[model samples]
Target: MNEEDLSVLDTVDILDSPLDAIELSEPDSATSPPDPEEMLLLLEHPESTQRIVAARAFCELKDERAIPHLINLLQDVCPLTRVSAAYALGRNPSPVALAPLISLLQQDWNGYVRKGVVWALGNSQDTLALKPLIKALKTDISAVRLWSASSIVQIAQLEYESVVSAIPPLIEALRRDAIAPVRSNCAWAVGQLCRELPLNVVYATAIDALIEALAEDQDLGVKEDAKLALLRVGDPRGLKMIEELEQEGWI
Candidate 1:
């Protein structure tokens, strides 16, 4: 991962601005961070605009009280409302929202809504998120697939067994994902997961993937990320490959 602690692996960042569709308009710039109790009321307001603003408010609010309301809005007729609500649930992250979030991710037609849902599921850090996230990494649209790689890292931090489960998909994505950034994310995730694993088949497999990318990937950015992953994991095989590649003037 990067030099910033936990950010590379643990943070669920949306590179593309999915929120651009529902930017919050602060009613009053004067109030230092608005009132959640009042925002909660607005959450169910009749107007779709009101609901969008209210849902977006909870994105910064993090009040657990908004969890159920946000979950309800997951099915909103408006894609913008549903997307905002998904993001708010990500900020709040209640277990109650997990199944609903997963449901939305699987069935929602809007890519932005599904992207937000993927982010919430990742931030929730629930084991149940692992399978869906893996599916997203493998099968979703590029934007969603990008977040899925990083989110898998978020869950893998919880346990060793989870790390074991996470590595294969990550390695698979790194080796074959068509998008360069998605593959780069998989590389970063693989390196971060390696920190949790002992020297074993899983560990060796991860190192092998990184080395392969470092040597063979077409994108220079992807190659640099793979090189960084190898350096971070500090596997002998990876370190040796870097050395040989440097000696041969290939890196």
Candidate 2:
């Protein structure tokens, strides 16, 4: 339609109905198109709401085109926005997203942001993330440590031998971490790793942890994970321990 004819229809429609009644369709190209300039501007917006919304919009756009702007947003003063930016970058998982995420994993003050970095690292599946992820597994926050453990699992899934090299640390983590989830993940990753490594490397330590978890952990799921890990690792001695616990009426 001609602009004048469209204008006439717009005027008539406005006259006939309230603005809320007019179904204004969003521009088709506006849905997920990259807008680096707008994203950059939003990064400096005084309102966290605008900054977070813009960061989320950029993520939903899935534009490698916005990598630079998104990277800059990784340091946003608002923890919420920084986390949103981290997540957006993670979802993109471009090479451009890698350096910034690694940097964030090292230095970001928020555990949530670091968790996002863990996810980004897993998405990239870069072996370079191994040491950093291992270090992050020691983070005080349960959420951060959980992702770090999962990233280790992801790496294990790819480089089974290299992951076996991670076994001592994983065993130590299960041996020591205070968090139930971290210990639980440590148990699970060890079970998966045992399938790939010489069973001797993981069998004793993992079986001990799983047996303890099955018997002593307060969370039933954690106990169940321990049971399952024992099954996967398949130690006859571990089963004997469970039977001993049952005989003692400890189960």
Candidate 3:
């Protein structure tokens, strides 16, 4: 056969070859968890995959001793290792991990890494993360902003006070974020905050912003989310607007 024809035949043979059958082993429930020294050694392994596996194992073990090691991995050469470290930190909550996670959220070059940091903050449920998450709304990256908004919502659900400082930025995000989903999520976050805050407390500006979004935002999804937010905040103007939309069949 000519070289080209032989190459094609070789390719077909490789494609048709049977895959290796991998054996799976179940963990022994009776076996003891890995000692701290063993876990630390794994975290320092030359292979990134081994380090990641160790981080996940720490998560499953919920060992607080792994917090510092995981935080160190947040700056690992591999982004995947950093992501895994963030995930492990989130799964295993520690007050000590809070500052490191926040720092990573702000400084991580990778958006996915920042995303993982956001999840870790949300999982921490520490009200201390509230302002940083609010600031995250202004992030140019949509995914980070989206998760930041979600983390805000999660934190607010636990502590109403967490949303108090978040209001102005959230309103701004709803009014002006370039991405429709970020704007939509901001509207949802604002609505959630308003619902928890006292009715007598004046969030007149926020109410007005949502009203404007409902009336004039370019995106239909933002408008709808704004309407829902306003309704959630129990704004009379929002109720009126929804009624009008329903009557006009524009809802």
lDDT of 3 by residue, 1-251 (tens): 23233233223123111101100123458997656678778988999989977875665567777888898999898877787788778778789989999998887776666767887898888888887888777853676787688788777667656656777788888888877877888888878777777664436666777888887789999988988888777878778878987798776
Clashes of each: 0, 0, 0
Cα error, candidate 2, residue 72 (Å):
2.1
lDDT of 1 by residue, 1-251 (tens): 12242222323354475484333333456768867888999999999999988999888777888999999999999988999999889888988899999999999877778778888888898999999999999988777888888889998779888999999999999999887888998999999999889999989889999999999999988999999998998888999999999999888
Q: What is the clash count of model 1?
A: 0
Each model's lDDT: 0.86, 0.68, 0.74
Q: What is the number of residue pairs that collide in model 3?
A: 0
Q: Write the per-residue lDDT of candidate 2 for residues 149-232, one digit (tens) a residue.
A: 777877766776667566777777776776666777887887777667555635566566667778877766666677777777
Residue ranges of candidate 1 with Cα displaced over 4 Å: 1-15, 20-31
Give every collision pair in model 2: none
For residue 210, model 1's alpha carbon misses the true position, in angstroms, by 0.3
